[model samples]
Target: MIDFGFTLSKSSTVDLNKIDHSRYDQLVKLVPTARMCMNCGSCGATCTVSEYKGMSVRKVLYGIQRGEDVKAMLSSCMLCGKCTMVCPRGINTRNLILNLCKLYD
Candidate 1:
């Protein structure tokens, strides 16, 4: 059977110089309010799917910012709007998720 989970070499760290910024830039344009995120954890606290492992808005956003693989986390989002309702910054969390989905497409 294929292992699919082989460990990387110690030197295989992420090359920050090779990271792509196009997708992130497009997302910023589509959802300007995303830049206002305070990493306050309100969105994650209110997420309906937060109880599930590996599904937090804050973590997903951070992954996106770093150009990491966040597709799984984004896919798990229920888009219930609860995060938006409780966001202290009044960010449109639902729309942000929708826009992020479009970006991955």
Candidate 2:
């Protein structure tokens, strides 16, 4: 019999002032439609991956805006274009995810 009592807890504090704004600025410049996101949750609701996993396009974008590490979430995107089709704000969700992936790469 093996008893496992080990648990890993992840915790970190983000300093907004310390985050490099230039990277985000460059990203926005590359994907101008990203700035139009209204955070309306439409993208998240329409996401196929989000239904299986907790990944949401809106959340990932917000994390990027806050300079948070969202590589894992960003990688989960399928680029199926469902989110973009449902976007009321007309944000290019697929392209945004691709750009984020490139940024992290």
Candidate 3:
């Protein structure tokens, strides 16, 4: 058996650092759905792209909180709207992701 470890390159590290927590304010500022994510995996659970592209919808917000670049998840989104429908808070994840895409991409 071989144990393989993961290595994040220098550029990736830079992207992680590029996350500015201040952007979260925009979520509350521009959209009411922004602050609604309760860190529930429901968004991640319902995300269509997660299975294919390895994007964690919940982590994107968390990453943003930690000042990490979640911009990667912005484009991989499938825009299925399932997350929004399933959300207990009724957060419009589809729209939130779209707005985040503007900043991510």
Candidate 4:
């Protein structure tokens, strides 16, 4: 039997606590939507793509605002508009992702 774990012991030469919140710090605050979401899992649950890669149309946008690389989400959307219809907020999720696509480019 062999234990294999890559571990770094404490040392003055290594500064493990590197601060890196620049992504979130540089993002513009998302304007609060007038249409309140009921927190229904309908969008996440019924999402056709979720079965493949597990995406929430709502959470992806939130993650983008906080400056996450949400590219993994792009592939999952079928653009079939199921999420838009189910959204109580009437937010155009597909359009949001379409616009978000430009950022990655």
Candidate 5:
């Protein structure tokens, strides 16, 4: 057998039942528009910082749901409203981000 310099990475599977969903639930309650996101990636595509720094609203939303600390990521957002403009579902992404910030604050 040939020796490889690298090894397989650990599983990235998330156990949803084990994670706390209170934050996400509270966000949805605060901003009902958040519940309508379908992860279409349009927001990310139009996001001003996404191409330069990988900032993405979708990722923030996912991070909230997964119980991950996303304050650093959210800090990169400029609140430009470009994401909201391109969203197919008419989700107010800028407002969502604002509410997320408040939720985390």
Candidate 6:
């Protein structure tokens, strides 16, 4: 058997039905604005931490929905409120981030 230069990468598929969503549901209840996000890059673009640390509010929100641990990512957030100012949906992103952090505590 001949080996190819590279083998197939591990599956990146996420089985939404199998992943736990209780945490995300709780977040939405605490911060209703969590549901208003449209995954627009605006929040990430305006994030101060994102400029150097690659911290993205959009990814963090998605991570919560996927049941992935995002505490470390959330820690990088400076709560500067730039994301809140730029959100087209008018979501209070600072409040949402605060609430998301509280969900773990």
lDDT of 2 at 81: 94
Worst 10 residues of 3 by lDDT: 8-17
Estimate the overall C-alpha local distance difference test score of candidate 5: 0.85
Q: Which stretches of candidate 1 lie over 4 Å from their true place?
A: 1-15
Residue-by-residue lDDT tens digits, candidate 2, 1-105: 565887656764667786766656877998898888879998888788886666777888778777778888787888889998999988888888888788874
Per-residue C-alpha lDDT of model 5 across residues 1-105, encoded as one tens digit per residue? 676987879876788887889989988888888888888889898889887668888888887888777888788889999999899988888888888888765
Better of 2 and 6 by TM-score: 6
Q: What number of backbone clashes does candidate 2 have, counting pairs of residues 3 or more apart or in separate chains?
A: 0
**Residue-by-residue lDDT tens digits, candidate 6, 56-80:** 7788888888887788878898899
- The TM-scores, one per candidate, come to 0.80, 0.79, 0.73, 0.60, 0.85, 0.84
**Relative to the unseen true structure, what is the Cα RMSD of model 6?**
2.9
Report the Cα lDDT for residue 58, model 4.
Answer: 66
User: What overall lDDT, based on C-alpha atoms, would model 2 receive against the true structure?
Assistant: 0.81
Task: Write model 3 residue lDDT over 21-56, tens digit each, in one string.
Answer: 667877667667767778878877877788876676
Clashes of each: 0, 0, 0, 0, 0, 0
Task: State which candidate has the highest TM-score.
Answer: 5
Model 6 / residue 88 / CA error / Å: 0.6
Quote the positional error of residue 87 for candidate 1 in Å: 0.8
Give the deviation of candidate 1 from the true structure as CA RMSD.
Answer: 5.5
Q: Write the per-residue lDDT of candidate 4 for residues 8-58, one digit (tens) a residue.
A: 675534232553343323322222331244556667877888888888776
* Location of the lowest summed lDDT over 10 successive residues in candidate 6: 50-59
